[model samples]
Target: PLGQLPVLEIDGGKFPQSLAIARYLARQLKLGGKNDLESLKCDVIVDTMQEL
Candidate 1:
C-alpha cells in the first residue's frame, strides 16, 4: 500500500499565483465580506497589495 497512499490531508501544495490563493483562503474563512460593499473593499485591498 506504500505505492498507493491515501490522501489524508494536503500538507504543502504550491499555488500558481499567490493572489489567487489569498482570495480563495479569504472566501473560505468568510473574511472577505458579508455583503457587496464589504466584498468590494476586500477586493480593493487585495488589488492594492498585488500592485505593490
Candidate 2:
C-alpha cells in the first residue's frame, strides 16, 4: 500500500512510514523524552513496541 494512511504532510511535502511519521510528530510537538538518556530509553521502547 504505497498510499498509506499515516502520512505526515509538512510544508507542502508528504512523508510516509508509520514509526517514522510518529517519531516526527512526537518530536514536533515535544511529546517525547527530555534528555539523551531518556531519549534513548524512549527510542528502545518505541522500537520494541513497533515490532509488536
Candidate 3:
C-alpha cells in the first residue's frame, strides 16, 4: 500500500512498510522491550537501519 515495499498482508488487511510490520509483530509477541526507553531504542535502531 501507498507504494511502500514489503507490504504485510495479514488478518485481511494490508499494512505497509517493514518497520510497521515489525512493530506490529513486536507488540503482538511482547518483544518490543520491557519499558518505554528500551522500546524507543529498538525503534531508533530500526529507523536508522532503514535510513541507511
Candidate 4:
C-alpha cells in the first residue's frame, strides 16, 4: 500500500511518491554522493523497499 503524503514543500512541484521525492531532494542537495555507484546503491535500496 502507498504511504501518507509528506508535509514538505518544493519549488512549485509536488511529488506523490515520498521515496522519489527524497531521491530528487538528495540530488538537489548534493547529498546523493559522487558517481554511478552511489546512485545505483540508492536505486537498489529503493527497489528493495518496493519489493518488500
Candidate 5:
C-alpha cells in the first residue's frame, strides 16, 4: 500500500523501504555476515545490484 513496491509488515505495522527492511531481517537472522568487513562487502554487493 505504501507505493507499488513491496514492504515489510510486523505486528500489523507496515514498514516501507526494501533495503532497510532486508537488512533488518538479515541481522535478526544472523545472515548478514560473520564479520563487520564481510557485512560491508555484502552490503556493497547488494546495493550495487539494487542499483542495476
Candidate 6:
C-alpha cells in the first residue's frame, strides 16, 4: 500500500499527497485561492502541516 492513507480520487485519477489533493479539491470546489497572495498562503499552510 506504499504506507499511505487517505488517498484522493478525482475523475478516476488518483492523488497521493495530501496538499496536492487538498489544492485540487479546493480549486474544483471554488474554495481555493483566487490570487497569487492567497495561493501563497495556502502553500505555506500546506508546508507547515506536512511538518506536523
Higher-lDDT candidate of 3 and 6? 3
Alpha-carbon deviation at 48 in model 5, angstroms: 0.9
The regions of model 1 sitting more than 4 angstroms off are: 1-14
Which pairs clash in the backbone of model 2? none
Per-residue lDDT of candidate 3, residues 4-35 (tens digit) = 87888987988888988888888889988899
What lDDT would each prediction earn against the true structure?
Answer: 0.73, 0.80, 0.88, 0.74, 0.84, 0.79
TM-score on alpha carbons, each prediction: 0.68, 0.74, 0.78, 0.59, 0.81, 0.72
For residue 39, model 2's alpha carbon misses the true position, in angstroms, by 0.5
lDDT of 4: 0.74
**Arranged by TM-score, best first:** 5, 3, 2, 6, 1, 4
Residue lDDT tens for model 5, 1-52: 6584668888998888878877898899998999999899879977987899
Tens digits of per-residue lDDT for model 6 on 1-52?
3557768866796668787787888788877688989888887887899899
Write down the TM-score for model 4: 0.59
Cα distance off (Å), candidate 3, residue 18: 1.5
Residue-wise C-alpha lDDT for candidate 2, range 1-49, written one tens digit per residue:
3788777788888788878986787788786679888778878878998
Inter-residue clash pairs, candidate 4: none
The local lDDT score (0 to 100) that residue 20 gets in candidate 6 is 75
Task: Please name the candidate that would achieve the greatest TM-score relative to the true structure.
Answer: 5
Sort order, lDDT high to low: 3, 5, 2, 6, 4, 1
How many clashes in each candidate?
0, 0, 0, 0, 0, 0
Expressed as tens digits, the lDDT of each residue in 22-48 for candidate 1 is 777889899999999999999999999
How many Å off is the CA of 14 in candidate 5?
A: 0.4
As for candidate 3, its clashing pairs are none
Stretches of candidate 5 exceeding 4 Å from the true structure: none
Point out the higher-scoring one by lDDT: 1 or 3. Answer: 3
The worst-scoring run of ten residues by lDDT in candidate 5 lies at 1-10
